[model samples]
Target: MKVTTTLIAAALACGASFAEAQAVQYAGGKTTFDGKCVVCHQAGGKGMDGLAPPLVEYPGKYAGTDEGRRHLGHTVLYGMFGPIKVKDKSYNFKMPSFASMSDAEIAEVLNYVVFDLNAQHGSAKPFDAEQIKALRASPVDGSAVHAQRESVVKSLGL
Candidate 1:
């Protein structure tokens, strides 16, 4: 009876730890977004008109593809500037680099954006910290990042 009770208690503790981890993932993501991105993207990632483009669509779609996933890592690590079209709208703005953030933070925030905010990501796996870490070896300014974005968008047909 004592052995059975101990096993049950261990199982319960593991379940609680799993739940807490899940909660922390989203909560950290939300905190990161709110503190860093919400000012430009606004609540729910709606974005500002003629300012920052809405993140609700393309980012989720980007998460779905391999190159697109890399693009997300590049954009965040390097930042982006210049004019880009999203849907039927155009945005010519400079997005500052978030290179200061840790790899895990980048992954978590992107997972929040791609999974929680945008519903179109489909079966895309959550952004992993290694991906962000790999991109960190080469650093580029926001303008170069924007130029690369043009290529990425064209290739992806976004």
Candidate 2:
């Protein structure tokens, strides 16, 4: 009985730690988004007219599948410029590179975006730093935004 009780206590403690860590991460993400992405994506991820694409319901545009996630991460780390389509709407704007940010912070911001959008639109799978790192390592120049989008679409069989 004592052993079982000890095990339960340990589990509870670990769970609490995990929850605390997640809370911290979420807070960091919120801060990063406000500092960086909010200029265009807006505080609510709704974006600005004729300036940036809305991040709400963006999972439908960039997270419904594996290919979408890859594309979105690449776009985020390297930035995107020129013309692209989101939710069948064309957006010709510049997204500045956030390469200055640490991979963990990038991940946190992405998690916040994904979680917020998913909650709004009912999607699954939030992106993380590892995925962002891989995309960043690849050869994606923001200048060639359309090419990257085409590649992602091809990969998605879209």
Candidate 3:
């Protein structure tokens, strides 16, 4: 009976720690978004005209499938520049890289974005930490030549 009690206590402690960690991660993400993305994406993520694209709906260009999620994660970490099309409109804007952000923080911010935006846009799936990490590890050129915004939009049927 004593051994069983000890095991139960350990399990509870572990669960509590896990929950705490999750809470911290979420809070960190919220903070990061507020500091960075909120300015352009806006508090509601509606985005600023001529400056940022609305994140209300998953850009037909980047959401839903794994490939879409990977593209978005890479874009967020490395940034995108030059002319890009979203919702059938083209904008020549610069998106700076957040490469200095820690993996955990990037994951957290991404999770927050995916979950919150998906809810707003009625998406069934959301990007998670693991997905973000995998995308971050993949090779992406954060260069002007690699922007390929028009082609990507065309491929996505945007």
Candidate 4:
């Protein structure tokens, strides 16, 4: 009976640990990423070759600035097409929009990419739902987002 009780306690402890981990700061964003982004961005945001750009570096850099931050929101909501360069490599693909998702969800997913996946630790604030809502008011197609990339890149000096 004691052995069985100890095993149960161990299981309970592990369960609690898992729950705590899930409740971390970026948990909401991580959940959104796992569902929507992992397929393309892949695990740990490493991205795919000749396809999606690895998000690990740029996202962190983007979160630091206003234009870049806005670009992040636009990219997710509008998606992007055509060729883009990241880490000196070229990626040409069509990213699908997630416009149907709520503003809060988009913000959460961006936060996941910028802070959690990219590990951007600094004064850059977590994106708010209202900011995303504001961006949502002006909806554009993926091409527009792609076109806007040059300006944003210039602003970020990337």
Candidate 5:
């Protein structure tokens, strides 16, 4: 009985620790976004008027789909270039890759963008490091990533 009780206590403690870690990570993600992505995406994720496309809407909506989720990971990992339209506006800019960041950091930043900034509570499951890892395993360039985006947008009929 004592052994069982000890095991239960240990499990609970571990659970609590995990929760706390996640909270910290979420905050860190926001910080990372502010420090790294804000230059072009802006404070509230509103990209430059015509220079950089706003990251406000599409990111969350993209997270809602399977391919879109992959796209998000790929975009961050490989970077994106060329012209793309968002909110009925055209943006022809190059988004440099952030492949240097760890998978966890990438996941956290996207989570911040999808949940905090966009408030996309109804979006698909939050991205995990494993997903980022898988995408990173098969590398692609920014232009190809942009081409994939076209397909994703078309499939969503957006």
Candidate 6:
């Protein structure tokens, strides 16, 4: 009984530590997001009315699949434009490209969106710099990214 109790306690402690470490990873992402993403996405990523789509829902869904994950990276690297719908709401704004940002920075920002804003802990996977870098090589325009998003959304079975 004592051994079992000790094991449980250790597991809890480890979990707490892992959570703390995970939070640390978001710090850089949060800073980058605040400086660049906050004006459109708002403080909590609730998004603006008739303007930007909320980051809270789709990002978690996007993190679930390989294509979805690739779409996330392409969105940042290429910047999506034209009309797009989120949660039955139509938004037709042009999101500018952030291709100048390094791979690590982009990954961190996406990590912020996927994990912190979306509250997708344990349900979605975190992004790494390598993933974004891989998408960087094959450059495409914002229109392509938007098209990719369309296909990815459908592929998600939504």
Using lDDT, give the best candidate's number: 5
Tens digit per residue, CA lDDT, model 3, 1-158: 99999999999999997985575435667789889899877875677777777666664335655556666777778887766555666566577888788777787777666665445424425456676677667657655323544445566676
lDDT string, candidate 1, 124-151, tens digits? 8988788888889877778777777777
Off by over 4 Å in 6: 1-25, 121-123
Give the residue spans of candidate 2 off by over 4 A. Answer: 1-25, 120-123, 150-158
In model 4, pairs of residues that clash are: none
Per-residue lDDT over 1-158 for candidate 2, one digit per residue giving the tens place of the 0 to 100 score: 99999999999999997986575436778889889889888876887777798877654445767767766676777788887666567778889888878888887887777775445434546667777777777757787655767777676554
Model 5 Cα lDDT, one tens digit per residue, 88-144? 899998999999999999999998888777755464678889999999989999999
Clash count, predicted structure 1: 0
Which run of 10 residues does model 6 get worst, by summed lDDT? Answer: 116-125
TM-score for each model: 0.80, 0.70, 0.66, 0.83, 0.81, 0.81
**RMSD to the hidden true structure, all candidates:** 8.3, 9.4, 10.4, 3.7, 10.3, 7.8
Q: What TM-score does structure 2 among the candidates reach? A: 0.70
Q: Which of the predicted structures, 1 or 4, would earn the higher TM-score when compared with the native? A: 4
Stretches of candidate 3 above 4 Å error?
A: 1-27, 59-61, 120-126, 143-152
Q: Which residue segments of model 5 deviate by more than 4 Å?
A: 1-25
Q: How much lDDT does candidate 4 score?
A: 0.86
Residues 3-31, model 4: lDDT tens digits: 99999999999999898686457788888
| Residue 147 miss distance in model 4 (angstroms) | 1.8
Model 6 agreement with the true structure over 51-131: per-residue lDDT tens digits: 888898888889888888888898888889888888789888778899999999999999989888876644577899888
Candidate 5: what lDDT? 0.87
Give candidate 1's root-mean-square deviation (CA, Å): 8.3
